[model samples]
Target: MDDAIQTEPVRQKKQKTAAGGSKAGTAERRGTDVTRVSEVSLSSKRAATAPIAVLLAAAVLLAGCWDSREVNELAVVMAAAIDQADEQNIELSVQVYNPRTAGGGGQVGQMSGGSGGGAGAFVVRSAVGSTMADAMSKLQEKLPRQIFWGHGEVFVIGEAVASKGLREHMDFLLRSPEIRDKADVFIVKGKAKPLLTLPVPLEGNTAQTMGKLADIHLGVQVSIINLTRMLAGSARGAILPLVQLSQSEEKAGDSGKIPFMTGAGVLKNDKLIGYIDVATMRGAMWVRDEIELATVTVTPTRTERGDVTVRLVRSRTKLVPRIEDGKWAITVESEAQGDILQNTTNVDFGNPLLAGRLEQDFNDQIERRMTGAIEKLQKMNADVLGFSQAFHRRYPKEWNKVKDRWDEQFPHVQATAVVKVKIERHGLSSSGAVRPNDEVQAE
Candidate 1:
């Protein structure tokens, strides 16, 4: 009985110890639960505030371009022109797309002259002031809606305005945030306003036609950005496509008048110095490595054959500049591969020997063209052929010495053209389609 009594007390003591451990574990679990709840609450608070912070930041960023106007309140500009109004004033002309005339679908005439039969699809408007900005402000006063320049794709400069200088005009164009840098720029013959007023049968207006032509590389394509870089680069010489109205019976006031790009205008220091004809422009393009593809016609010298034309499939040009004893010289190394477009000669192009002769003739023709271009550029003392760029890239130290006097030294710099042509294809026939009487042979 004594032993049982003692063991019972011991067992009671052990149960008390076990009960204390269970209470301690419960307290630790409750503490853990509280910590988890506090962490979740903190995270939920952060998540709730995140969207507000994002919204605030978005509003701040959107404020930059938030000055938006409805389309109906905008007079969309399709093209623009700058001209010398007089010795003291300048003129700014804009062609605005008329939504009323462009909205309806119908016949060709109806499509051009929409529901109300309004004044075609576009209208030309002009304002005169002492500067481009002033003229633009005055132009805004005349328009019913706010002028929108975001859609403009073409800018034409008149001969008189270009000759005067473009620094002041360019300043405004470059400063305007609404203007696009990729817009095509052109130098038009005579008055720029008249060109804008000319009736165009296709593409809504003359501006569309001009932009399409530039995109196709019809002439020397120079965008606003390109002209800016050329003006600012080591060679302050820029080339722009020259616009000329087509000579046809259709008068300027007629509804079917057309304007086309014929040549390139050369500018030195942002001032128009001279104009390059189509042939010389091609040569300039070759020297500048801008020839995409060209169709060249030449009369074969080996035999008394007729004219043969070739369409260059691919071409590459490299300008090699060398300074020998301070004598600066640049060699134009060009290579071309082409297919015979028209073979009016009696000889078969399949013969390697005859093909060789044709190749030589083609090379000679290209060389002559490039030489003529170089001569003309030298005469003008304009470095629009990338000669300045080439020399500067090759010999930076030397370029710095003559850069100031480049105008005086450019006319004397020696330039030569070396061309190689490979006749890759002779078309389906090796001879002319119309066999000559002398080539007649009995079957």
Candidate 2:
């Protein structure tokens, strides 16, 4: 019985050991399977996450639609015209661009296409309201696309609008971010819209043609920035190139019928006071130091008989203001270089002595003409010459005393002008086929 009991205990120990080994093996195998399953799940998760990451990145890129504007969605303004519709209403006219004509040529694959229509590149739209902004907004409602002023090249203000005071109306132009300050500004004699309606010749648009003409032949091409500067200055007066429709029927032939710059409109405190002809504008140019190209015809009292047209190559003017004995005097000194363009009378062309005599005659003529203009401005009491500013710079104390009464005192002020001109370069072949009467006698 004792032997049987010991054998039973040994058997029980064996059974316990076998069960423990089986349980350990099963747990180890289960752990391996769990790890394999986790690995497979992780790989699947990574595959799914890759596409989500790409999609999220694309979403971030696609989110920025804040300021996006398609080319066709904008109504590009090429020029603007401002006029006074009535006592309390302001008229705004815009020349809007057509994108069909503005787009690049050709089809999807090719790079070429038919040229756009030239005349319809610009479309006119106008509105009337109490203020400039109001007028613009009213016009905007009629436009199918958003108005864009970035490309605007011209701004024309009518005489009625300018004469009434443009400072208030022009505030929008100064304040707008899209409106370029470099755009050229002109003052039209009649309604501003009429100037824009004129047919353009070689150029695509009337605004561009006017801009080119203003730079080349007009009095002075005053940009929006220039106009602002002049208006903001202490002088509080300015001048703008005036454009008038040409009356010549022949001008309507090859070159499309269009208006040309005829004179300058004088503005006092942002209001059009009057117009100055081309001759007077030359004098104003001297005061402003802006003479680019000019021709002077002077009849020299000589051993000769006709007049000579001297074409000026370069010209400059200096202003000197003096205050003494409770009175003001301004001295204008101008110097110029010219060439004899037309010789109506035969004179010694090669002689240096004759050239000196011609130079003296040209100088006298310029002085007389410039002096007359200075006298006229002095009588008009226009400080367009900036004499008041010069006085302020040189004699500050005197300026402080008389600055208030400058307008009243300017008309009576005395002005002296001295002009000196030099004739450089007689054209090639000094003595042409035409001989002088004296030279003929000698022959």
Deviation in angstroms for 352 in model 1? 2.2
C-alpha lDDT values of all predictions = 0.85, 0.76
Which candidate wins on lDDT? 1
Model 2, C-alpha of 424: deviation from truth (Å):
1.2
Q: How many collisions per candidate?
A: 0, 0
Instruction: Encode model 1's per-residue lDDT on 1-443: one tens digit a residue.
Output: 99999999999989998999899999999999999999999999999999999999999998777676899999899889998989999989898877776676422222222112244567677889999999999998888899999999999999999999998888888889999988999998788876677656666578788888888775788888889999988779889899887744654444556778788999999999989899999889988888886899999886665888999989999999999997989899999999999977777778787888889999999999999999998898888888888988999999999998888878888998999999998878877777874782211
Q: Over the stretch 1-443, how does candidate 2's per-residue lDDT look in tens digits? A: 99999999899999999999999999999999999999999999999999999999999989888788887789888888998889999889887766554454421111111111233456678888999889989998878899999999999999899989978866888899999999999988888886665445556556887888777744777888888878777667678888876654556542345767777888878888888777777777776678887888877667457677778888888888887887788888888888878766566556777777778888777777677666766666566767777888988987787777777766876888788888776676344337655562111
TM-score of model 1 relative to the true fold? 0.84
Give lDDT: candidate 1, residue 421. 98
How well does candidate 2 match the true structure, expressed as C-alpha RMSD?
13.1
After superposition of all CA atoms, the RMSD between model 1 and the true structure is 5.8
Off by over 4 Å in 1: 1-37, 44-65, 105-118, 249-253, 434-443
Q: Which lDDT value does model 2 have at 290?
A: 84
Taking all chains together, each candidate's TM-score versus the true structure is 0.84, 0.77
